[model samples]
Target chain A: MNPTVNNLAFSTTFNAAGARYRGIVLSANVGIMRDLAFNASYNIQSAAYIGIPQDILLQNTNLLDGGQITGIPLRQGTAGLSYQQRSGFAARIDTTYVGSNNSWNRNPFWFANASVSQTSGRVSVGLGVYNLVNSAAQQYGLIGAGVFVPQNYYGGGAFGGPTSAIQPGTEEYGLPFRQYWLTTKVSI
Target chain B: MYHNHGYLLSDDFASAKNDVGFGYTWLHQANTNGQFPYILCNGNTQNVFGTYPPLSLATASYFARDTWMPNDKFSAFATVWVQRSLNTISTHFDPRLSLVFRPTTNDVIRLTSGRAYSEPDPSLLTPAPPSYGSPTSVNCPSTTTGSGALVAIASEADPNLLPETANDVELAYGHRFNFSTSIQADAYQSWENQALLSGNVPISSIAQITVPQHLIAINIFSA
Candidate 1:
């Protein structure tokens, strides 16, 4: 007599995998005027996995292509300018850029921020706005249900599986939209 | 002949010229709700329960440093730091040494080395195993001849996980061009062990399964 058993399982665990990152950073600060200063910086980076196959697949069936490590952006840069007046008033503007790279998919984004504050005696107040342009860009990606489901549903065509069966895929998303706020600081 | 200031109350000893200092610091953190309660699953959608343990853990660290200046151009310093945790990991000891040399008024050089360690996250230290729902069998329709099935998967935590550790060496040089601007350069190399990551383990298998659906569970560990 012959006996047969069927079992399937999916699990995620942590391993001591290795990765390498190399990059260069350039920054400068210039005194545009007596009370005004300008600063800028640029960062360029390249990251790759070590001791792992370039095409290795994760538990979610997503391929780790190009030896790309997760959560590391290849290129990013920032520039800002600040001005301070003798009357205890200061204002600054900053902008940032993130080059497109793959977490799971390509994510390129940009945003700007500005603030103005006035100090009188012991109290300081300011107003600021984030995501000045309100650009819609995906900042992160993941593999999961309802987020990025790699599945197709049919009425038991060939395998006679339920319609809820899932395929393999990834999903991408960005951070919150533009926001504005006010702040106050008191010196003790 | 020597001159004495009122900075010291007792200066009779010859070693009294050396500086002595003492410092103490304390930190207390409490785990609260909404801090880390859920794990992100799939892509962006769907949240899995059981990310953190019900209990709370606290950690404390202390450090002391001493500096000795034998001459006007050179100084050496050493520090010892110790840390202890309540529930995550055992105590850790770290020692560091640094030497600074000033060859000229415009140039300064420093060499330093240290060992550092960090405990794992509370959630990862005590992880909630993934819970897969019951599996259901699907019968082949009139067109197909075989059957299929589906299941959900989750991950488990490792209790024997160790804290991450690293040994680092650094060399720094600084030169003053003028009072308003200066140039500094640093180079460092580090060797790290017991790094944490996620991996998949096959808990079960399926055979003769035409259309088998798998729910993979993952485990956390330090390597």
Candidate 2:
């Protein structure tokens, strides 16, 4: 239609006109020593700027909800400390941060996964906790633009207050907090 | 004032005796997995289920611009506005300096400069079909599945989407006649960034969106 381009309203992988995006990637890193270090990498994306089916996500709500993808912040940051003791053992503890997660897109999460590894003989074992902060960051969503207001409501009744002539459900569902996890691995 | 036009008068503004007020915002930008988790669809763009970005956006705002008139020849202006909510209301301190060049007793040249946040029109943010009271509705083309992705109309909200931020520069000229009626025309241009947009992605069946508590999006300048 002739609607103005305002919200990134459409879906990705299948976005419409104003939704076209030329995706990109970003990687963040740091080190306290050498091999005993910590690093993180994230996928930077906008949308299907130069394709067609890529525009579907922007048009169909059912697809956006089930497609396992959406417009989110592909951030995975880490903060940890690792060490090596030559013939003894190697250990490490790291903190990771991921923001802008959505539910319908299979990405409602921004958690921390810390770990510690030890190498004794030919095998190396490690364990760590994830979302250790104990956060229930739920990923949720709502209809994009089909809210029916009851006329008398002050906000216009949809979802999200900005347009809701009614003042209800201001704090909708969608969490960008941390959840915990446990991980382990062995090396030979 | 910082937020309420009178709140900028003190340091600890909460319980001040003045007319100043207070406000707050979550200031949390969408980082990952939301209504449409920003898929690393590519390099410069992100896809939610797989959509696209927009070209330009249009918006409307209701704000009380502060005005400092140091007499009549010189005056100043600034404003603190809240678009989304009481919690999201911020002092978008738009401080402006103007010169009242009165070539004739009935004419004046006004030069104004300041930063402005062009908020989305309530109509745009509210999820309505393509049209209003009119019986017409924005419908998908008759084409079911054919050529390239021609339509990209998402049925959800892009909350992380931010209100367009721009440096508003306005040059206005006002003229008043003996009849006390004045007509003013403003020539303006905005150097803008972080503008919000919505594009229709050519999805085969549907699209996904995140709309919970009105998602609050902000741009944090890291120095």
Candidate 3:
């Protein structure tokens, strides 16, 4: 994490000698009042390199074979705000947006969540939400190794490889990411 | 010697893997001699070190400091850190804290307390596996891949091993130089149990392995 004290910046990423990804970011904060205030910031990142971890691809360039994989997110936005009362009552809503990701990472969608609560009374109850949009989510991807094999000792079928019913990327091995759970908390 | 229909030399090929006292040391790659898949029982050595002697190791440390405060007693600080290992079966989390008190103003002295944590990077302490592995994975290429490197580390997940833990306490003092800018400092410390580290042993290293055709490298080492 390079520490750059900047309010905004423009950056670009290249893939296969082509302008793959580029983006601009905008952010600012101001005092709407004193105790009850508001602040919001948005980022617009567009790049053909959105879903892929390019560094990994670049590192293996010298391997025995080839193919190309890259990700692109046409645009993305993130914004949120909060409201609080001196009475210990507070509420907030947040938005995590992907502006129509046009690449393999998938379709652009926004996820919104909100919460409200008041601790003024004896019994306090808080209700929260997640994945309000319930947009289909992809947790991860499966990639295969190839082009060269260490002589003929053991093909990819070692490590109990083809022998066992277990394969990491296989659908049989549950992918750990997509979800929307409802949780509630009660305090006395 | 060839008269018996066999090419022979004085002790040319000694495939004496059956020697009783010859122990195998765990290595980075080739733990299987490229014979058995990862966990298949192929009569290979259960372990290179064949049950390495319960790994035994130890460490000790000490520190001292002199501090000053307003009441000639306001600024005070002290701390100590120590650890040890025995038979590759050990863990400890220890932290120390101390402070002095002085009253330059009415609100200078403070009673403080807190909980400190020294969890190793889940990746470092334990193995953080990718959801998937490159086709020709050396250690973990399949879902049998690994829950974490720690799982295969032997040092961790040795059913006998316990989750490391630690606890801490603190006390401090400070003063405001002005409204916008001020000087504030605190003296603190803690003691912990089960700090963690990889108990991994290295054996023959992995050479180069490639398979399929689209092979894209995630991490590989080649000269």
Candidate 4:
């Protein structure tokens, strides 16, 4: 058999395209008491491609394969309550819920944040806590061979076959499970 | 006809406050060469390699606005905008109307409606054509195996993309309970068409391995 006769090659390309995003956001803020206030918001979004190549296999039925448009969470929400006093004291606790998103096979996760601050004349001191739950979530990933070189025509080193293994595309990870920091500000 | 405030109709027209303004805006993309740099496996550019696309384009818009306030109780405002671009929809017209009504010292109502258009991203407006490279076998430094074979890849650009447009209307009401407390509520609805996004395209395996075949590939790069 002639190696040149059976040479089979494959490549990938992108085109300027269009997609649709439809959704509604509802938010509310209310006073629980003279010194306490509560606020929350919820967003519901549906996205689809106006025009997609019909040949590509659909990885996600709920979302358009190429049109899924990464980084957009279908459902996400945050709620928080705050308390303040005239004597220069304030505190707040808030929780965020990120619905399961397919941007990079990321699962749903919830995290809470809290902060306390006190102000005296020209100085203010505060402390904050992030990712109270400490959940390890993957925010994004790449779908292709795992190598980091120029291979095949697409740009990265080639994998064993057409269906290459998926790998992490970025250095971004889910919010740190639990982290704390202290902050102080002075205005003179 | 006689006026209730003892003012003639001509006097009312003369006393109304009126204002007019005109403005111009220009946006240009600094790069137009539409060149994508890719790494070549060997001396031959046809061998498999890496690539990145750069973008370039420009647009301009002109607008005029007019406001008429006959009295403190009510006012009317209108604006018209015309935008020109290099996209498929080269020209677009957008207009807006606003009405304000004050029934009491602490109560106010506002109604607004408008049509707006957003051009596609400059990067997406002009895409470089796809390139081809021949498969070459090479040694692998990272993998346990001593050698590997590189495959072919291709990309496609769309020049016929359209701009996104929306029609919106909103109603708002505000009331003041006291000097330090107030509440505001607004409800709005918008309809949009031709929104832009990234999607996968179908291409043949031959197109990727062959030399310079126009093909569309699945977007494997992540953000």
Maximum-lDDT candidate = 4
How much is the lDDT of residue A168 in candidate 4?
23
What are the per-residue Cα lDDT tens digits for candidate 3 across B53-104? 1211222222222232334435433333333322223434344444445555
Best by DockQ: 1
Whole-model alpha-carbon lDDT for candidate 3? 0.33
Could you tell me the lDDT of residue B122 within candidate 3? 23
Name the 10 consecutive residues with the lowest summed lDDT in model 4 chain A.
A146-155
lDDT on C-alpha atoms for all candidate structures: 0.54, 0.39, 0.33, 0.56
- Candidate 3: how many backbone clashes? 41
- Steric clashes per prediction: 29, 112, 41, 13
**Candidate 1 CAPRI grade:** incorrect
DockQ score, prediction 1: 0.18
Interface RMSD of each: 9.6, 19.6, 21.6, 10.0
The TM-score measured for candidate 3 stands at: 0.30
- Output per-candidate TM-scores for chain A, rounded to 2 decimals: 0.69, 0.45, 0.42, 0.65
Ranked by TM-score, the better of candidates 1 and 4 is: 1
What shift in Å separates residue A76 of candidate 4 from its native position after superposition? 4.3
RMSD of each: 12.6, 23.8, 23.1, 13.1
Work out the TM-score per prediction.
0.62, 0.30, 0.30, 0.56
lDDT of 1 at A11: 45
lDDT tens digits by residue: candidate 2, B1-223: 0111211221223222223333333322211222233333122223343322211222223344434454555544445544443222333444444555666777778776666555443334433222111213444333333221233333443323345555656676766543423455555554454534343443333334433332333122221
Better candidate number, 1 or 2, judged by lDDT = 1
How big is the positional error of residue A169 in model 2, measured in Å on the Cα after superposition? 40
What's the C-alpha lDDT at position A89 in model 4? 99
lDDT by residue for model 1 (B43-159), tens: 222233332223344556666767778887888888777766655557777888899999999889999998887666555545443444333442212321112231124445554
Ranking by DockQ: 1, 4, 2, 3
